[model samples]
Target chain A: MTPPSRFDEPWQAQLFALTVAMSEAGHFTWARWAEAFGATLKAMGTDRLLDGGADYYAAWLTTLEGLLDRSGHAPVDEAAATKAAWERAYLATPHGQPVQLPG
Target chain B: MRRPFGRCILDSGFGAPHDAPMPHDHPDHPHSLLPSDPALRVKALETILVRKGLVDPAAMDEILDTYERKVGPHLGAKVVARAWSDPAFRDRLLADATAAIAELGISGRQGEHVVAVENTPDTHNMVVCTLCSCYPWPLLGIPPAWYKSDAYRARAVREPRKVLAEFGVSLPDGQKVRVWDSTAEVRYLVVPMRPEGSEGLDEAALSDLVSRDSMIGTGLAGASK
Candidate 1:
């Protein structure tokens, strides 16, 4: 069997690094991030078929968004709006093209 | 920070439940052609944080490079081999793992508090982070997906031998199985018993026998290359 990559996806690496960088930058302490992540894990429950799959990372994203919102670094609403803009921009961009956010 | 599943009191008008199934695997967009939902979401967050002067993309890139290239299980293997070769280092590792590991130039986040559990003839030690996937990232780098799985978190502490059997590790009945539950505050590294008939081998050769799972206590070290 093939070995698993350090991260399953590029996005996973991005999320992981962003969390570390933010914590190092003092947006939130690693302990606080751990607390938030643990709470998210508890809320998600341990009965799912997911094992560090999309569902797991979904929980991670949820925790990150929540932490940023609470810390006033990036409110959830603003992130959501920006995400929506990205979705619209991506859907409009043709296949095989980089999805650029509207200026 | 418990996020209520349906809608949070602090809803940001996104409307969807916080735990709603992610559209990261959307079928319409080919996996190779388009970025997944999570990727786009990350991009959005990074863009916003960068604009707000709260995050530096370059710094994030450097961190990613470090994890991807500079850190991994080999580092943990070096520690294990050293412990196998040097009794004083092994004692120091067991007594105060964080400081001992620092002596080897291996210390970083998620590894500030480490405890080395050595396997003996009568005992075997395994580790799991039931809360979250807390692991020694400085030595072991990113944890395997299975290490963070709900199945492992729920079962490793309940029936450790059974879980170990699933990983192809079946200990003798006389050997007691001890499972360690790691936390954000403390992580664990399992130093597997030195394989028999390897006294002639050098430290580097011994290190090659030490696999990632051996350090995590899920597998035995290889007898030879």
Candidate 2:
């Protein structure tokens, strides 16, 4: 019962949760999300980018995106577009406040 | 990216068979962490994952709530606290860490190969994955962003004392600093020394003093020196 909130930000917590949620809900059936993630990373042609290896959530997001798209749910680039919109919202939002996507 | 399971393809948590085929065309940026802007990419991925019925928001909320309410260093702290209080379990942990940790029902994937290294006043141990961010996820959960940094991965082994200094951990000249390099097969978790005057503290209270960085050997338990 010591203090929690080990995650530094809301987004990190979100990514972790999403992975667990999706996995638990029986969505990660066909392939190892990790392999799917590797496949996504491989197909994205970012072989040159991962040399430094700093981003974990980035991998998670890519895996999630790949999973959804591979499962025939999301269209390719939909995640990318959403990502851009969120960036705009985040840029516009004031500091110290939750970034909300503008309607 | 941090590895999932000893470089092996993970068992899809549930057993179902649907091709997780990815859509192509978002060409690589070739030099950055995210192929696109960080915030936008994360949000875009999250939104689409939910919208396309690939995952459920409610389950996601539950997972979020679990990490917020249940997971954290407390899990690791508790194990350390228990080991500190119970010598038998400590021995068990040292002898067979995976089984020792599972005794508390606190077991998961990355925990499969985790080895616990205790820090004594004479010997201080720190962990780093020179290859990738192979962390002990069962107890500590996901690693802090810094743990996954290339700077730490490369620097931790070359200059353990300097890294410890940057982390505000100054070991005496005579104190031996052991830097355990994590690999795909094994990861190390440092069990920091129990601070004095904590004898009266219960397991839960003792865990309160254990910080996440302490388990990683970057910080210490917040007990009076």
Best by lDDT: 1
What DockQ class does candidate 1 belong to?
Answer: acceptable
lDDT of 1 at B63: 80
In model 2, residue pairs whose N, Cα or C atoms come closer than 3 Å (at least 3 residues apart or on different chains), thus clashing, are: A70-B21, A83-B40, A83-B44
lDDT of 1 by residue, B1-225 (tens): 222211111212212325432334535754224356787778778878988988887778678767877889899999999999999999999999999989999887642598899999999999998888889898889888898888898899998999999989999999999999887778899999999888989999999999899888999998332
TM per prediction: 0.84, 0.62
Cα lDDT of model 2 by residue, B1-225, tens digit: 211111101212211322332222323421112223544455566676766676777766656555556666778998999988999999999887888888998775432477999999799988987555667877887677778765676678899889888988888899898989876457678899988888988999888888899999888877332
DockQ score for candidate 2 = 0.17
Which ranges in model 2 have alpha carbons more than 4 Å from their true place?
Answer: A1-9, A22-75, A78-103, B1-53, B109-111, B183-186, B196-201, B222-225
Q: In model 2, state the lDDT of residue B199.
A: 90
Q: Candidate 1: DockQ?
A: 0.31
Cα error, residue A71 of model 1, in Å, equals: 1.7
lDDT of 1 at A69: 88
